[model samples]
Target: MTEDLEALRSAPVLETERLLLRPFTAEELDAVAAGEAVAHFAHGFPSAEDMDFARESLMAGGYFFTESVYARLAVVEKSTGEVVGTAGFVGPPIDDELEIVGSLAAGRRNRGYAQEAVTALRGVAFRDPAVTGIRASVPEDNAPAEQVLVAAGFVRRGTPGLETEYFLPRPA
Candidate 1:
């Protein structure tokens, strides 16, 4: 685990071929929680659920400011420089296992963006030697989301129910 909590607060900016996963600034998180429009947010971005998550994360001292590898990162589309969604660790590692959550704008789904972001997150989580595994849960009916996890090398860990749990162990 990184000994410096402050260093972890500033998450490294992760870039994929088409997406940029950068930590959300305090100002942006505040604006999101208040339902105010952020300039770079894409249309229909930050849905009610997203807003609630942002508010809750901020209320918990800003997820990024905690000991997690990364906080809530705005998933930006490179071509337009617009935030199409958000993704990050749910909280700091527990038993060397961390949970992650991510979502894209409704209009931007099914273009490989979710998988790309999840893969990047997996990369970040594994970078910390203390993180032995990562996990995610998707509603059973959300086949697309499940597919994204699978594409990112996460395997289903239990029987499907209201939500299906997935896990990815640190690479050898």
Candidate 2:
């Protein structure tokens, strides 16, 4: 993934009225991977050994970057510029399709940041001629996030209990 890392390191910064999405450096993200910082995406702390595996993978840059995915944006706060979360398409699983995924600071939910941030990322995704739609999988219990996705135009598509999927078409 050396090529993906270099491309991610070179992509342009994305901006919104209240957020800045950009390529995350190891310095910007080590805390999240190291378990030193609190994260809202995972259900619980991983075992220490799991954290170590993740730390090494992140430091080596095995993950796909935005440009490589050609759509995902690393969510950052406008004021602190600290990465508060991740928002964007699935980085590597597919390229022509963008699977929207996001998580905000636990204290920051219900404030419409997810919608605002997703809206901005949508702008980026639609700019690519090859991308025609975006999708997000939200748990059935996550009524708030479901609302945000609908407000952003995603509609329920499928899935069992914890895996319901919603999809929204890319704007012309």
Candidate 3:
């Protein structure tokens, strides 16, 4: 278990055709976790809940480690080198399953960034042999996120209510 945790803490950066998924710097994670403004972000976080989520994720990742698989990573636009969003597991996997969460900057939405980021994160999560599947829960009315998850190959797993659950099993 210690070796597994160490490996997770040293996970590599992930990249897609158009985005770079890099771990958040300690300072950046600290700021977001504290609900403080991040200098490089064009627009600040969308809401307090976003900051809360960031904090929770940082805690789950273990503060002071930048490469933990549960760490919230900056979703950078490769061409512009801009941080357009964040992606990460909600926490470490349990029973070979984990939940993924992501958010795009307000101005960066509707651009397919969420789908790209989520897909990249899924790859990262599955690289660990322990991970067998991933899941996501989005508000029932969040059609955009639902579409992004669907495009990333997540299928609805249960009845919809205030929130809908989606799951994606690792490829054979």
Q: Every model's Cα RMSD, please?
A: 2.5, 5.6, 3.0
> Sort by lDDT, best first: what order?
1, 3, 2
lDDT tens string, model 2, 1-172? 7965564434447788778777555543455467665442233333353344446547556455434444344566677555566666555325466787777666556767798887877776666567778888887788888899889889899776777899878665
Model 1, position 90: C-alpha lDDT score:
75
lDDT of candidates 1 onward, in order = 0.81, 0.64, 0.77
- Mark the regions of model 1 whose C-alpha exceeds 4 Å error after superposition: 1-9, 63-68, 159-161
lDDT of 3 by residue, 24-106 (tens): 77777677778676666647553465577667656666552346677667777898776667787766787899888888878
User: Which candidate wins on TM-score?
Assistant: 1
Q: For all candidates, what are the clash counts?
A: 0, 0, 0
- Which residue pairs come into collision in candidate 3? none
Q: What is the RMSD of candidate 3?
A: 3.0
Candidate 1, 96-152: lDDT as tens digits: 998999888898898999888888888888777789999998888899988888888
lDDT value, residue 159 of candidate 2: 75
Q: All candidates' TM-scores? A: 0.88, 0.73, 0.83
lDDT of 3: 0.77
Model 1 — TM-score against the truth? 0.88
